[model samples]
Target: MGFIDQLKTEYRVGGIVQRLIFWNIGLFIIPMILFSILKLGSVDIGIFDWTNPFSDDFFSLSSNPVDLLWKPWSVLGYAFLHSGFMHVLFNMLTLYFAGRLFLTFFTQKQLFGLYVLSAIFAGLVYILGYNLLPLLVGQTAKMTGASAAIMAILVATAVYAPYYEVRLMLIGTVKLWHIALVFIVLDLIYAPLDNSGGHIAHLAGDLFGFIYIKLLQSGSDLTKGVSGTIDFFANLFKSRKSAPFKKVHRNTTPPVRNSAVKPKDVTQKQIDEILDKISQSGYDSLTKEEKDFLFKVSK
Candidate 1:
């Protein structure tokens, strides 16, 4: 298959995190192509011009009051926007590894929740630092990149699975928590210096991720509120079906004798037991009964 076709196939079968990385890389490439064509025709596509924070079209929540209403969406959109190929590649690589680690413990909804929340917090930190800190340093700046979001995911995954270990190309296997600590420390130390606003943003995202996992462990879900809001709007466009879809109550049916063999019912307790076993001893250690129970429960 051709390169684009291969990418499409990967996107179709890959997890949500991989698909997100593909989409961002794809969007970044499109602008480069457009800019190249414009240059050949003696015209400027003004890609950088549009991206500059000081530019008229630059997206801002505070400076542009109207954008504040739309700023929440920017958290998502900014994740996909990149200035260069290297930038896209670096961010996607970090996302691929960090996301895989994150998914090992978190549900898809929780992963997405952390990602979106991280991006928003990152943007907020950038804005606050640039606007407020400039009073002391007499300088304002703009920031961009997926680093903040990546940091958030890295920290969240570490928080969730501190014992998880991964081998680096040249380095030996290391615990995930150690990696998270390095990033946090780096951001904290550099927040006052070069790319100060970006570092501040990264710290903010990291803080959100850390707090989110803590809340999750206590049985509170931050994502539920965001998901509920999304569902509220989604239901608006859904068409109302006919009343023929009315359901019959199970209580209305009389108990009938079964001729065929019935499968064993797997209760929630059984499922939890299987999960605990898998967590402690790994999936390969499961017996046939446990495997069957897990398969049924998953369905």
Candidate 2:
């Protein structure tokens, strides 16, 4: 296969978190590259000028309802745009680490659901905070970046592995929930100082992540429909690749019924793989289903 085809095959098998990171990076870079080419080539269209924040064509969700209505897609688009190199770097890194930690205990579908739902929630929170807060009344700001989504993933990981210890550079070993508490407190403390709208969005994402997991532990899977949504969109765009139909000859006589076979025991290879994942991450990283499977086989 060609390199592009190989890459596509890999992407098809890669989990949702990996796909999200790739999409975020691609979205962040492609706009600027396209705009730069248009500028260098002396394209004088008014749309090229709209790439700036001062223009309405910018991909940022604004605090004003009128501005939001003009470009409704910005609510989701803004989450993939980055203000600076360091901002994107930090956000992507947090997503990579936190996503890995979160996926250990949650399905890829759940991760996708939480990331998207939290972004939409954060955008609304950002708009409401800017428009309704007494000190910030009548103020408007353009919001961009994946910080809110990253915060949701980070807090989710910490909640799932509250007592799990992780060793950090200069910090030695610290409990996951302690780290989450520190972030929550810091965001609250700084909300009044600077970037208040952004902080509010972060807090909103944190709230959503916490609630998502809490409900999930109670046997509610918020992501149950996420896969259906994805499949619907994918099928809409995918080319027809169905296998050729075949007709089979039918037997004249009825076949005798056979007894139902009992399932085989769990294999050593499967247990080893689960054990390896636990060793690399932690016990709290195991999903409830995984825990149940382990319990059943341990006896």
- lDDT tens digits, residue span 196-281, model 2: 98999999989988887888789987777776788787776653565456678999989876555334423555556666666445
Scored by lDDT, the top model is: 2
lDDT agreement of model 1 with the native = 0.69
lDDT of 1 by residue, 121-240 (tens): 778766666556653244544445677878888998898889889898888999999889988998888877676766777888888889888998999998887767766766655544
Q: Estimate each model's TM-score.
A: 0.70, 0.74
Clashing residue pairs for model 1: none
Candidate 2 positional error at 35, Å: 1.7
- Residue pairs with backbone atoms closer than 3 Å in model 2 (clashes): none
Clashes of each: 0, 0
TM-score of 1: 0.70
What's the distance in Å from true for residue 91, model 1?
A: 1.1
> What does the lDDT read for residue 184 in candidate 1?
90
lDDT against the true structure, per candidate, is 0.69, 0.76
